[model samples]
Target: MSQRRPVPRLAALDGLRLVAALMVVCYHYLALSRSWGHNPVTVFPTLHRFAEFGWLGVEVFFLVSGFVICMSVWGRGLGDFAVSRISRLFPAYWVAVPLTALVVKKWPEVTSIRGWDDVIVNLTMLQAGNNTRNVDDVYWTLFVELKFYVLMAIVVLCGVTYRNLLIFCGVWTVAAALAPSLGFPALAAFAMPQYAPFFIAGIAFYLMRRFGSNALLWGIVLFQLLLAQRYIDYRMASNLGHVAAEHLPSWPVRLIIIAGFAMVGAIALGVFDRVQWRWLCTAGAITYPLYLIHMFIGMTLIHHFRDRLPAPVLVVSVVALMMATAWLIHRYVERPAGQWIRASMKRGIEDVRLNTPARRKARWRPSLPAAPEERPLHSAGVH
Candidate 1:
C-alpha cells in the first residue's frame, strides 16, 4: 500500500491571510468611525479612500478558506474532518463571543448587547438563525463560514473527488445565478451562490495543482472569473449605486482582486512553494481571533479616545493593541483550550468504544481450542 504524503503548509496562503485580516481591520476601523459619527475620512482622506475597498478582504478570505478546507480534508475521513473543524473553530469563537460582549457592554456603541440572552445567542454562533443580533457585526461572517463548512462537510461525506467537486461547483453556480430570479433568494443567501464562484475558483485551483492542470480545471477558473465580475457589477449597482461606484476608481479595485486571485494561483502552482516563513504562519494563526475580537474593542477604544488622540495615532494604537491581544489569545487561550477539548473528546470516544457492547464482546470472546483443520496444518500433518 502506498502511504500518502502529508500536505505542506502554504506560507504564501498564510501571508495572504495576514494581509486579508489587516484589510478587514482597516475597513472596519475606518467604516465604523464614520458610522459612529466620527469622520476619519476628513482627517485622513486618502487613507479612507483606500480603506473603502478593504471590505473585499472578506471575499479574499472566502477564496483562501475554500482552498485550505479542501486541502485540510484531502485524505481525512468525515469524522476526522468534523473534529478538525470543530477544534479549529469553536475554541476561538467561544472565547471571542464573551470578550466581544464584555467590550460592547462596557462601551455601548452601535453594537450594545441587550442582556444575557444576546450573549447566550452570540455564544451559540447562531445569532442570525435565532433572530438575535450579533454582539459585534463581524460575527455575521462566522455564520457564513459555518454554512460553508456544513456544505463542505456534506461534500466530504459524499466523497470528495474531482468530478464530484466539479459537478457541485457547476450546480451551485447555476443556483446562485438564478436564485433571485427564481424567487429562491434564501437558497442564494444560504448557499452563498454569489460567493460560490470564489470558493469554486479555490477548489479548481486545488484540483489543478494536486492532479495537474487540465481543460476542465481551466474552464472552472474562467467561469469563476466571469461570475466574480458579474457579482462585482451587481454589488456596485445595488449596494453602492452606479454614481458612487463609478466615482471609486474601478481599475485599481479590479486590479487588486485580479492580483489576489493571481497570487493564489501562483502559490497553488508552486511558484512560491519554497517561501516558508514561521513568522508568517504565526501572523496567520492569530487572524481568526483577531478578526473576531478586533471590531467592537477597537471601535470602543476609538470612541473613547477620539478627542484625546490624533486619528492616525488612535487607529495605529487600536490596531497594535488588538493585534497584541489576538496574539495573546491565540497563544494562551485558543491553542491550549482547543488542545484540551480535542484531547477530552478523544478520551471520551475511546471510553465509549471500549465500553460498548460490541467492543466488550470482542474483547472478552472465549478462545476455543482450534479444530483439526485449523490447528495448523503442520508439515507432518500431526493432527
Candidate 2:
C-alpha cells in the first residue's frame, strides 16, 4: 500500500484562485464583445488591441485548476477522486450552460457546433476544440481541463506513485511543446495548446512539498517567465507564432511579448505584487461568479455607453457592477447551491458508512471441545 502524505495547506492559495478567476474575468472582458475586446500587444496603430488578449485568463484558469485540484488528490487514492471531481464540476457547469445558450444562439460554423451537437458536447464538457473557437465560446478550456483531469486521474487510479506522477508530468510537459509536430492534434488544439506544462508545474509544486523540494522548484517559474519573454516571443499574440520566423530580426520584441504570457502567471499569484487588501480579497471570493457573469453584462453595458461616459468612470462602474452582481449571486445562489451539494454529498458519504455491515464482533467460542470448567472456588476456599 502506498503511504499517504499530509495535504499541503496554504491560506494564500485561496487568494490565487481569486487572482486566477479575476484574470479570467479580464480575458472575458476582452472577449464576448466585438468593439471593446483586449489585445495585450497591439501591432502598429493598434495600442488599444490589448483587450483581446483577455483569453489568456482562461488559460490561467486551466493551469490553476489543474494544479490545485491535482494537489488536492496528491497522496490520495484515485478511486473516488474522479467521481468527486465530476460531481463538483458538473453541477455548477450544468446549471451554467443553459443560461449561456440563452445569451446568444450557438454560432454555426464548420469549426463550432451549430445546434444540438454543440449542446451535447458542451453538456458532456468534452469538445476537444478547434483553432481559437470554443463551445459556449468560453468553455473550450473547461473541456481541456476535464480531459487532463480524466487522463491524470486514470494514471493515478492505476497506482502511479507521486514520484512517478512527477516524472510523468515533467516528461509530458516537455512533450506538449513538440505535440503539434508529433501529430497529436489534440495536443496542439488552439484553446489548449501545449498548456499541460503550466498545469504540471503546479503538480510538481505539490510533489515538492510531499518529498523534499528546494528553491529551484520555485525558480522554474521564474525561469519559464524570463525564457518565454527573452527567447520565445510568443506572448498572447494570437497568430504571432506564424510570423515568428518572419520577425526573426525583431527577436527582442518577440522575447518581451513571449515573456508577458509566462510572467502573467507568475505575477498573478503574487509573484509581481504583494496584495494586502481585505475587500479586494473579498472580491476574490466572488471571483468565480464574477467571471461567469461579467462578460455579457459588463461588456454590453460598457460598449453601449463608453462613448457617453468617461473611460475611467466607465471602467469603475463595470468593475463595481461585476463585484456587486457576483456577490449577490454568490450569497443567494452559488453559495447556497454549493452548500447544498456539499451537504448532500456529505450525507451520502455518511449513509454509505452507516449502511456498511458492521464487522461481526468475534464471539467467545471453544477452541477445543475437550475443555471443561473447574469446580466452584467457594468449595476450594473452605477446604
Candidate 3:
C-alpha cells in the first residue's frame, strides 16, 4: 500500500467546517445589513467595518482543502484526483450555483446560463474569472478552488511531486504578488493569482507537515490580515471594493500569510479530529451547501425584513435561522450526497489498498506535508 493514499474517516473537522460556514454567513450578514440601510458601523458602537471579513473563512477552507486534497493526489495520478474532486465538489456546486440563482434569487439573468455552452464549461470546473457574471458572486471562490485542485492534480499526476509543488507555489506567490503591477486583475494564467497563495500555502503545508510553526504563524497572519483591512482600498469602502492587493508585501510576506493560515487549518484538523459529538460532526458535513446557499437566504431575508425587524434582532435572527437551516440542509442534502459519492467511490473503484496499521502509523504535523512514502495508501491521498 502506498502511504500516500488513505481511506476517508470522519473527524471533528466538521465543527471547524461549521465555524467557517457561520463566519461566511455572518460576513454576508454584515454585507446585507449595510445593503439594507442598517449599517452596524453606525448603529452599534464597537462594531468594526469589515466584521464581514468573516468571509475570509473561505480562505481557511481553501487552506484545509489544499492540505487534505494534496494528500489525496500524492500517490495516485491526476485522473483519480480529478475524479475525486469532481465527485466531491461538483454534485454540490452544480446543484448550488443554479440553486442560488433560480431557487433563491429568482433572477432572470440565470437564464443566461441555460444552454450547453455555459453548462459544459461549468461542468468542467475550469471557469473562474472568465465566468464571473453570475448572480451570486461568492461562488467565484469555488471556481478558484476547482482550479487549484485541477492544477494540483496535474502536477501530482505528472509525477513532479512536492519539489515541483514547492516551485509552483513559489512562482505562483510571486506572480500573484506582482499581478496588479502587471496591469491585470485576473492574471489570465491563474485564478486571481493573489488568492493562489492561500491555495498554494495549503499544498505546501500538507507536504511539509512541520509542527514547530504554529501559533506564531497564525498570530502573525491574523495580525496581517487585520492590518491589510486597515489600508482599505477606497474602492471597497465606496462599496465597489475597499482593498486590493495592489501593493502587497514581497514574496516572503505572501508565503508567511499562506503559512499562517495553513497552520491555523492544520491545528484545527489536529485538535478536532477526536471530538465525539454527533451534532457537531453533522454540522460540519453541511458546511459546503450551507456556505453555498446561506448568503442568498440571509441576504434575501435581510432585504425583505429590513424595515420591520430591529437591526440587531434581525442580524441575530438571520444568523440563527441560517444556522438551523444549515443543519437541516446537511441532514437532507449534503450528507446524503457525500454518502452517495463515498459509497460509489468505495464500492466501484479499484484503487490502491492499505491496512489500518499503515494509516495509524501515519503522522500529521502542523502546516507540513507528509512525504509520499510516509502517508498511508488509502485515506492519506484523496486519489
Against the true structure, whose TM-score is highest?
Answer: 1
Task: Show model 1 residue runs off by greater than 4 Å.
Answer: 1-8, 233-246, 347-383
Best by lDDT: 1
Candidate 2 — which residues are off by over 4 angstroms?
1-9, 27-33, 36-54, 105-121, 127-135, 186-193, 215-235, 239-284, 339-383
* Ranking of predictions according to TM-score: 1, 3, 2
User: Candidate 1: minimum summed lDDT over ten consecutive residues — where?
Assistant: 374-383
What CA root-mean-square deviation does each model show from the true structure?
9.7, 13.4, 8.9
Model 2, CA-based lDDT: 0.52
Better of 1 and 2 by lDDT: 1
Q: Against the true structure, candidate 1 has what lDDT?
A: 0.77
Q: Candidate 3 clash total?
A: 29
Instruction: State the C-alpha lDDT per candidate.
Output: 0.77, 0.52, 0.56
Write down the worst ten-residue block by lDDT for model 3.
231-240
